[model samples]
Target: MKKIILSISFIFTFVICFAAIVADLTGTWKGLIKFGDQKLELTYKLKAEGEKLTGSIVSSYGEIPLTDGKIAGSDFSYKIDIGGGPQESKGKFMGDSIQITSTFGGNSVTNTFKRVAEK
Candidate 1:
């Protein structure tokens, strides 16, 4: 009986830690993406349901809808269709920041987003 109780406690602790890591990323984030001399401000609103993520991006140019976003462990992948063109980006989410790398128009760019306090 004691052995069973200890095993259950260990399993419960592991499950809680996993859920916390996943939930750490579900929120609204804002940042900037710079490519050469051009820069754009971006807002990302993310909703995570289980392992699936759905969100939208708003920028100075326009709003792009995100679809089929998913998170596996600490990595995230998502696709966005903007103005009839599809672009995909993948990155890792660190505690207060996310490092994203993508290619647009054959040019590769890296963007890092820092979390801002909600007002």
Candidate 2:
């Protein structure tokens, strides 16, 4: 009985920690991507409400709507369709930094983004 109670408590603690890790990703993050000599600026806006998550991405070209977005534990995946061409991205949510892998034209880039400060 005592062992079972301890196991339940441990499970509860793990669940809370998992939720908190994903919740920390609720904000804007900015970073730069370098391709040899060219550097591009990237921005991500993520919002979480209850168990639902939504967000968008803005770059120099334009804004892309993130669809079918969901977060589980500290992992997240989202989809974006650019003019009918579909793309999928997955990333790990860190406390202060987020690393996402995205593919374009058969090329993929993984970027690290730091959380933007709220002003």
Candidate 3:
């Protein structure tokens, strides 16, 4: 009986930890970029398979594929090509929001994204 109880406890702990990790940024997200006095809204559709992530960004410029996407704990990072310019972004997930810092064309930009419900 004691052994069974211990096994069940371990399973329960594992499930809780796994769910917590998966719950962070496991869906579509939308954000806006602000540079100096200019702002542009963008949408990111993301899918996570295990520790690997796949996504794309939709902006007025066009759709860009997210490459080399990875996630560790609450930290996430990815790279994308926007109009022939390579850019990389990294951030931490908090609740339903993620704050990311991206560098492009020798300029660093910060953005805050909110998780969007899938249609």
On TM-score, the candidate that comes out on top is: 2
For 4-107, candidate 3 gives per-residue lDDT tens digits of 99999999998777667756677788988887898889888877766787889898988888999988777888998766766788978787888888888778
lDDT of candidate 2 over 1-98, digit per residue (tens): 99999999999999888778767989999999888899989899998754556899999999987888888777888889998577998888878899
Q: lDDT of model 3 at residue 37?
A: 92
TM-score of 1: 0.84
**Per-prediction backbone clash count:** 0, 0, 0
Clashing pairs in 3: none
Candidate 1, residue 28: how far the Cα is off, in Å: 1.7
The better-scoring model by lDDT among 1 and 3 is 3
Candidate 1, 52-108: lDDT as tens digits: 878888887787778779888778888887655778888787988877787777877
Clashing pairs in 2: none
Tell me how candidate 1 scores on lDDT.
Answer: 0.80
Poorest stretch of ten by lDDT in candidate 3? 17-26
Off by over 4 Å in 1: 1-6
C-alpha TM-score for every candidate: 0.84, 0.86, 0.79
By lDDT, the better pick of 1 and 2 is 2
Candidate 3, residue 98: how far the Cα is off, in Å = 1.1
